[model samples]
Target: MKTIQLFFLILIIVSCSSNKKISVNTSKQSLKNQQLIIDTDINTENIIVEEISANTEIRLKKDSITTVNSYITAPVFDSILKPKHDSFNKLLSMFVSKEGFVHYKDLKKRQLDLQKYIFYLGENLPTQNWTKSDILAFWINTYNALTIDLILRHYPVKSIKDIKNPWQQRHWKLGDKWYNLDEIEHQILRKMDEPRLHFAIVCASISCPKLLNEAYTAENLEQQLTNATQDFLSDSTKNSISKDKVELSKIFNWFNADFTKNGSLIDFLNLYSPIEISKTASKSFKDYNWDLNE
Candidate 1:
């Protein structure tokens, strides 16, 4: 009996040890599962934060694009300067009065309009094969358009030089750069170096050439520019060619440096002037009229 009892006790002790080992293993497995759950939760949180950040960046970019689209350029001419058919004439009309005067509220207002419209035109200008006349027409329109803008806001002065260091002011802001009226005239337009520009652009005064009632077209641009130059020279009040001395408008004197760059004013004039005149003729300056060119 004692031996039987001993064997049974030993068996009970072994069974208890086995149960303890099983409990330990179950506890370890439960801990591991808890840790995995915690790690999964952390990963989920990180993904949410990344998604939120991405959404915020997208919203900001969209807002920036919207602001850019709202911008416009200074419209000095409407249907009168650019053909309305499939063009931006309607948008151009927003910046000018029916009589062709820019609204002089402030620089910011003008800048907003100018920025918007220039971009619009640049984006929408025809891109197919174009003739020199087409290119010239666009340039002339741009020059006159910009000139009218400068005059409407500021005029009645003796000369464009009368402005008090206005060149420093940010007139036309484009592509992260600011351009003054002088740069537009001398650099961009004159660099093309076309003489017809002299007659196409106006300074908003009677002495300057008349602003064409219609926009210049590529088909007739060359003829138009030539006609403009001829008409201005023929007008006795503006320019008169004589055998001895060549009497000319103040424009020749003011912009004499431009003409004189390649050759003398007499030479430049002789290229277009029909009447015969000597190169050694006496050079005289004419007074400019400041009367409003209505």
Candidate 2:
């Protein structure tokens, strides 16, 4: 019986030792697994932060480029010209006849008002900061105002050419300098490279584009120009068109290069012409009337 008791005690001791070893190994493996999970979570958090930062930087760079582009391409203008243009508009509505004729005699009676309008234009000539449309509208109004002033100064003149060096003479003052009609038309307006301008300017002659009844305001310049082009083209006396041929104003012949710069003259005309002139259609210039539009 004593021998049996010693063997049983030995077996219990061995069993307790094996259980302790298994418990220690399990605790070590659980700690390692927890550390590995924590390491993976930290790496994922860092990747998310990096991706967000990269996307933000790309957005900021795109915004900066858009701002620079806007500054470069956007047009700027003077606000002061609008009210002065309003005054000119009043005078134009009052004195300009329905057929686009200027009553020089009537305008001469209100010379102070006319001179005041012209003086405003001369003093406030457009600066380089002004938009291309603004500059074009200003010069168109200026050219017409100066023409009327010329006619009023020499009332009853048969033709603009009757006046000595009418276009060449630089008697008019504008923006602290003297300029002639030719300078305004050729040196400034034509150089702007807008072919539609040919239909907006007038020479106070029957053959020239009809002087607009209202002043050309910067706000409505594009629409006004489009209207002028359509009106001029629609005038059968100025431009006669048929299935086989198109007879255009002498103005087109004079400024063929301007109209043909972007495309063929026929293509340009087809934009506004009611009659669809074929590509191979014949073209001719109408006889220009030199008499006063009045």
Misplaced by over 4 Å in model 1 are 1-119, 122-132, 154-178, 260-263
| lDDT tens readout by residue for model 1, 22-70 | 9999999999999999999999878866665554344333423222111
In order of appearance, the predictions have TM-scores of 0.53, 0.72
What are the RMSDs of all candidates, in order?
15.7, 18.2
46-154 in candidate 2: lDDT tens per residue? 8866665554344333422222222122222123333248877888888887678887778789877878888777756665446788888889998888888887777
Q: Where's the lowest-lDDT run of ten residues in candidate 2?
A: 68-77
Q: Give the candidate number with the greatest lDDT.
A: 2
How many backbone collisions does model 2 have? 0
lDDT of 1: 0.61
Taken over the whole model, the C-alpha lDDT of each candidate is 0.61, 0.80
